[model samples]
Target chain A: MHPAPSVIFFSVLSGAGFGLLTLLGFGARATSQGWPAFVFFAVGFVLAVGGLLSATLHLANPKNAIYSFSQWRTSWLSREGISAVAALSLMGLYAALIIFFDIRVAPLGYVAGALCLFTVFTTAMIYTQIKAVPRWHQPLATPALFLSYALTGGALLAGAVAHAGFLFLLTALIQLWHWNGGDKAFRNAGTNMNTATGLKGAVRQFESPHTGDNYLLKEMVYVVGRKHAFKLRIIALLFAALIPSFMMLGEVKHLGALIAVALYFTGTFASRWLFFAEAEHVVGLYYGKR
Target chain B: MTALPETTQTKLGLVIDLDTCVGCHACVVSCKGWNTENYGAPLSDMDPYGQAEGTFLNRVHSYEVVPDLGTAQTVHFPKSCLHCEDAPCVTVCPTGASYKRTEDGIVLVNEDACMGCGLCAWACPYGARELDQAAGVMKKCTLCVDRIYNENLPEEDREPACVRTCPAGARHFGDLGDPDSDVSQLVAERGGIDLMPEQGTKPTNKYLPPRPKDTLDTDIDVLGPLLAPVAEQPKGFLGWLDRALEKL
Candidate 1:
């Protein structure tokens, strides 16, 4: 709601990190030999979970963050926290299963991957659950976050996959689709606001309600120049979806994997920034002209 | 076990009618006036001359609802604490300052117990609880607890100030816990809806449905029929001068 870039980056970056780790964990067990896969899994998992935990520490009162787990029955914030912790624990246990029991417990990789998928689902739900934010309200938002995690994780997993090269390419394409959908959601949100505010019709008369700036005006209502926002959206679309997609399918298969991963991650970061910035909170209507 | 008093039940709440509300903000002004003296800390404005800042318990917000019609209608929604049955604010309070009463389901803050931690504010979805800067305590709509129970005040005048001063009769104060109360009956008849009900706050305060102006169902032709026409002739010197100028 604050539209803080730090928070937006924290969620998207950590989400991809979690997605990458969860896939690596699953790949480890799917493989015949477990040592190389375990290395990738451990690195990805730590980067994802550690980043999230560090970001959460910046909260003014981290002690109350514990109570965030209590409202899982209703609140998506609670559900996200719960699933994140659960996914982390499951990944840790999966690692233990590999170390202690050899490759025998490799099937647990599936469990860890499932848990990670669910974790991202809950994370996506955190944004989707908020009705006030029309941009985040789309049905596409959940799946886009879901697929971004998969593509990000799959790209990381592509480095570990011994034979299935197509999986990586497929995942990249899915990520591209997700990015397109997310961009459309932002567009739809803008259009919805224009319609709701009566800015869409032929003759538009706009008059603001507040005589002076208020808290809602300061926090919720953000004014982004149309030309600048359009340019940014194009940049985000190229970085997040198109370039990564092309690289993933390019001639140099081995090199393409690395390029795709880099492009996807960078694009996701930009896209995530756009996600928060482009969103217009309906509460802003109170300040907007009648 | 001590028996609960049948008549002295406490968790007071207000139900507001969006349909009847004229959006005068009398309730907001009255709330500020009453709470300024009674509450532990008064709402303060840091730079009233320069920046215009002050805290208030009640603020009225206006919204536009577009129906299947040619024009969009305005609906005013007044925001305040709903005193939820399952208050996330209470659960998130580490210092035990925010607590819900089992007696009346009203969530309240104990100023003495508060450590100035703002967890409860973030936990609230409705944006009801606000931090009081001067006293370093959280303040909210108390359902006018002091006024409602004051024995010195006459029975007719004992209700919350917002309800008493509402010239539009949009505000209703009563026990929502009782099925037969005036507030409950109003809610039932109007099919009141909660703001963001998906948040699962179970807010006690409900908003009545918006009424349509088309419901008047009157004929414009019938009202205007047979009205005498107004004269359009110039009088005295102006009339004669106009005729002379035309002739010249």
Candidate 2:
């Protein structure tokens, strides 16, 4: 149920990117925020398109991605696909509305934000509905994805507001801590043999059910060493937790904020990859040896 | 000639017994043999000699259960698609490749429509559906639908390949909706149970409860306990510790 990094990045990045673009699309028409509007609009469009292409690459049959939109009534995946496409289309229309009609609709910004947030929810629910992948079923994944969107969006917003003053750094710092805390929750609700095997109070033992490897083991169990995990945990904490704090505090150079963004994206992508690799699907039971 | 009125209801399913099953896996082999030949594509084996890679519709798993300390008994559970009333797999299929008949509860796949997304397999808790790597489509137990409904087949032999070929007579096939059906009556008399009842799948197939070889009614000898010493231990550091623990 753990989507590939390409998928997770596609959701978190595009969601926040679209959300910010929608806000910018509305901002362009408002006489009050004219100069600032172009900045948000440019960045939003770049991130949205970039993230969408990244997501599309993960599909085995990209042409059939269009078919995914047809089953919204029964599938959250279809709902997510439809909403993402709709959100993108609306953003385009909003831009046209501002350019041609010279219309300034504040409610459009709110609607776009709502759509972006719903995309994130649908993305998270896709994993939550899975019965075998219990790690994704924890209460943590939904909130974690939501807060990640907010923090990522907020960081970009703070960078945008730097032209006004240094004041927005405080908000960015607070959001950074919130994002990292959610990441910790995601890591701590670790899936273990006790849950996977359903042994209860008894000790569960296994004799190599298969003589050789199969698909489940190859896909699910990554050969993540303890040393490597510890090392990566440090990296995740440093980027997601510490560097952002330093950047906001002005303890580092102004360019450090950009470094923080790079670090956060790289660290989160690695963590997401590990999340999928580390999770032991119960189907492993058919072939597992313990 | 005028057309006959169509029956409003048809219920298709399987019945499995827990008590009589010997865990031989004959049904598993028969199912694989029948489905591979009849389905969209044969269940291919990638490395037949080097590794096990063929697709299977049914698998017999063995579980050991102990009722008492005397001995443990092996429970053979043959699992496949349960054809549940609330099948999430059918609902989640985007291409309409997966569907459940309203007339009969049988969930089926249209191989031509399946894009090989592998979503239906994830939705199934029983691990019933498997991807046929060669065909690039999902496959599973059809309850021998082709054979069961074939008019050319003998009336006595019309059933799933697995049920018809079972050496132990462990599997039965019938309509549970009718209370008088043999499978239904047997289930009522034996007190069958569903695996993982909390899932709420409402599986049409029922497993007759396995009766343990031993029971809790075994008599305990009284003489061993009566012969044990009640007096204090020999006086030492160990004795003092033992006395202190006993005093509590």
Candidate 3:
């Protein structure tokens, strides 16, 4: 569960991008807070597309990624792809309409908004559906991620600041609750040495399967300290939710708004890092790394 | 194609016996040697000599099992892909690259279509799948699909490399789907159990547990306390030893 920097970047950047796009979809566009409609839309698009492109950074065959769009029927990953493409296209059309002809279609905005929400939902499901990583597989994961995206995106967008802030606080509390639950999830996941090997009686790893580092150890066995995680969680709560909530109460129409968004990004990045680092894969039991 | 068959025509898998495996790693090496050359792409290795860490489809792990009241035994456990009836690896593949064969039920990765997202490796509970860092693709035991189905090879050698090279005769290859098959019968007689049955993967592979030991059943003569040595004990060698000891 090593959090590849590229994936971490993709999740945080694309989340903010999609969040901004979701806000743009309501036809309540804003040119205030040093974010022009065109620039805003462009930045959001770039972040989403950039995040998508970044995900391919780890791919062995990036060329074959196009074929990935084919399995939308079964895979959550494919569903995410299709949703992202469709959402991006709808947002493109909406932006084009607003930019080119000085027109605004509320229905198109709503359509893009709905699709945007679906895209993020699919993204969250991609991790939640993985039963091996019990930490992410929970009933609370999807809503927590969805609310996080909306709150962050809403801050970058305009109107409903109070509503989004309140939701952000709720989700932030849930994130902390979910974070605590993840530790218990690994403990209560009920996977141990005996279960892994299907053997009876007391079993301990006398020797590792390999003498040196291998693919499984390199990829799955990530060890982050609990103390460090707690500190980061508090930092994430402070910037991602608390301070942003306080900022929403103040007049954050210009510089204050940018500062708030910056703080939120920093906070979200910390949480996302924990999301991967804390994930205990079942395979780790064999090596006694869990 | 990511969807598994309603029922596989043949559940082709290996039944590994833990009681006999000596942790020799012959099957591991033979598996690596055969699949690296036979398969679609080479099992890529980074710093294959300096790091000497190469992709291995089969891995032999040795563990010390100490029961509450019995002596400990070292068991060598060989693990690979179980090619489950409901393989999450295939379903999670965003592309139709990962699939289970309808003809033989050997789960395989279509390298041409694989994007190497490494999600399949993560989905697998048993550390069966591996990401080839050199090739930038996910690699795993293919049940030696290339060798198992190769008509060029002799009929006797049409088994997986691991089965053929296992010096201890710990690994067996056959269709586990048929109740009358040798492997199926072996499972019935030996009570071979699946690894992590709770995951509900319904793994085709089975591991035969180590045989129970009888601690109190010994046939050797028990030793008793010796009488004090006589002053004029025994003959030539015994006399010399006694004299030598008296001199000391």
Candidate 4:
């Protein structure tokens, strides 16, 4: 869990886009197929597609990503990739129908919205399903991620001021619950030095595997001081949850909504960074990191 | 291809003897030398002369185990791929790149299909899978697949390089699925235990713990023989004879 920047950005930005789309979809009945609809559609597409493309930055061969879709039968990453494509395509078509045909199909919009949420869920599952990463491998990870999207995207939409405020507060509570619970999560996973080396008695590393670093050490072994993490968590909470909730309550206008969106992005990014940094991969037991 | 079989035909893996391993790193080097040439990708070295970070399929580490005791001994632990029965690296793969062969239960990566996302490396608890940065691919111990099944090699040579090159005979490779196989028998006799059984990967590889050290006898005078002769040195007349005898 190196917490590659590209992945962190992708998750936050794309989740926002999908969240915005979901908001728009639900309001399709009241919202018109007019200029404002076109604008929301454009912004959501840009963020969504751009974020998806950015996710490939960590891939050694971005061109080979197409093959990833073929493994959806078992791989959560594959399911995420394929679902993102389907959600984008359907949502794009729905927007096009509104712009060109002067039509807003309710069923199509709802289907696209559901797919968007599913795509976000799959993205979270990419990490949550990993048994080796105990922090993410809990029932709480998906809820936290999905709720984060609702919090950020609802702020971006700003159409229903009262609803967004309510969602924002709920998301913040869920985020706190997930964070606190996840902190104490992986200790019971049962990975230890004794289990790693298969020795009955207490085992300790007397000598390192090498004098220099290796790929496993570089990629999986990361340490963040608890004090710094606590400070960052407060910042993440303020910006991601509390600040946005206050802004939505104070003013649901365009200016307030935009500011909330910006803060939510930054907040979620910080939280996402902590997500990877805090994750306790079982391999850490080998290096005595956990 | 990434889907694991309900049951593999034969579980081929390794058993390491912690008691006899001297930490000489012979198996590490031998595996590097043999596999660097045969595996789909060369075990490349970045700045071989400068920082000299070379990728090896096998690595050895030393550890100290204490049990409320005064003494300790260094135990050399060598690790490689365990080829787990429920190998998550294969199932979590976005592409069908990483896989375990159902026939012999040897896990491998199809270099052509690997996108090098490094998720497989993350799922492995043993720190076995490593990303080859230059090749843009993940690498692990192939169990010397090239040599093991090579028809051109002699029958006796059809074994993992690490096992064959181990001077202390600490590494053993064979079909672990068969109860009568040499490796299986050795595991049974030595009471071999799987690494990280709690993880439930059902790792095929096993390790034999180091044996206890012999207790020291404090009651018997250990330095008595050497000090006694000097203390009992004959008087001046006979001292010359003792000195002559010592010299002789």
Candidate 2 vs candidate 4: the TM-score winner is 4
Q: Which of 2 and 4 is ahead in DockQ?
A: 4
Q: If you score just chain A, what TM-score does every candidate get?
A: 0.75, 0.71, 0.93, 0.94
Model 4, A163-242: lDDT tens digits are: 66777777778778778778877777777788888775778888887887778766777774444788888888888878
**Candidate 4 residue spans exceeding 4 A from truth:** A28-30, A224-227, B214-248
Q: Report every candidate's CA lDDT.
A: 0.62, 0.61, 0.82, 0.82
Better of 2 and 4 by lDDT: 4
Model 4's lDDT to the true fold? 0.82
Question: How would you class the docking of model 4?
Answer: medium
Model 4 DockQ vs. reference? 0.57
In terms of DockQ, which candidate is stronger, 2 or 3? 3
lDDT, candidate 3, A217-262, per-residue tens: 8788887554598888888888787888887876667788778778
- Clashing residue pairs in candidate 1 are A207-A289, A208-A289
Give the runs in model 1 whose Cα sits over 4 Å from its true position: A28-39, A54-60, A96-104, A139-141, A157-215, A225-229, A250-259, B1-26, B29-55, B62-77, B81-158, B164-170, B175-248
Candidate 1 residue lDDT tens string, A4-104 = 65466567666766777566555643553366556666666766676676667545434445555655555555666777788788777776666556543
- lDDT string for model 2 (A1-290, tens) is 33466776775567557656644544522553334545556566677677777876654434455566677777776777788777767766665566556665667765765676566667667666665545555455444544454345544444533321232233334434433553454235443333322222322332333345433344333444423655665565565445565555554455765676676566555455544554444455443331
lDDT of 4 by residue, B126-197 (tens): 888988878888889999988899889998889999998999999999999999999999999988999888
Where does candidate 2 chain A have its weakest 10-residue lDDT segment?
Answer: A196-205
Q: TM-scores across all candidates? A: 0.65, 0.75, 0.92, 0.92
Q: State the TM-score, rounded to 2 decimals, of chain A in model 2.
A: 0.71
Residues B1-248 of candidate 3: C-alpha lDDT, one tens digit per residue: 68888898799999999989999899988988898888767787778678678788889888889878777888899999998988989999998899998988888998889998988998898989988777777788899887777899999788999999999999999999999999999888888998877777889998888878856565544442254446566679988898899998
Which regions of candidate 2 deviate over 4 angstroms? A1-9, A12-16, A19-65, A96-105, A139-147, A150-154, A157-234, A251-254, A278-290, B1-11, B214-248
As for candidate 1, its interface RMSD to one decimal place is: 8.2
Residue pairs in clash, model 4: none
